[model samples]
Target: MKEGIFFGEGMKFVKDDYPDIYDAVVGLNKAAYTGKVLDYKTQKLIAIGIVAATGDETATEKQMRSGMNELKITKEEIVDALRVVLLTSGMPAFTKAMKVVSKL
Candidate 1:
């Protein structure tokens, strides 16, 4: 399988040791990106916010990079999303997200 930038060592281990479950997860990921109502770029931005809200620095960074690289997402748009996180998820989550965004 091609190496995924966002997928860490644990995901690689699961893909190697639990192929069936990994396949299921891969299927679910595909299903999530089908773009029934929302477009892929929008979905990716939403994913970034959700990941950031969880306070996973690595995942937030990966998602931010992926969104920018693949979807051409603007830093301004990302900051706008983080504003929502600030209002709903609080300053800590927003600050953490800002730190990642600042790096990019």
Candidate 2:
């Protein structure tokens, strides 16, 4: 969800130390987010489910927040994605994702 950073990484370091790399990453993000077949909102929801499935709390929270803020994705929509996460990823991931959603 961050422009050029993933998880809680510092963007300034990447921007200052690896400017080209940072730009490429940002460019990748742009390409990834551009809606083609699936809309960006749906893409965002898929992203949420993915990070949630991986059980990465910080990334999951960030993606969830980004989807909600930027795309107006609802809690219900997130929960629906979490259902898929539950099926593919299991209870622990689902619980952790639910916790993140609860905090929001």
Q: Predicted candidate 1: what Cα RMSD to the true structure?
A: 2.5
lDDT of 2 at 57: 92
Off by over 4 Å in 1: 1-6
Show how many residue pairs clash in every candidate, following the order shown. Answer: 0, 0
| Model 2: per-residue Cα lDDT over 1-104, one tens digit each | 43444544676688789999878888888889778788888988999999999999988999998888877999999999999999999999999999999999
True-structure lDDT of candidate 1: 0.84
Predicted candidate 1 versus true structure: per-residue lDDT over 36-75, tens digit per residue: 9998888888888998898888989988988898889999
- Candidate 1 lands at a TM-score of 0.88
lDDT of 2: 0.88
Top-lDDT structure, candidate number: 2
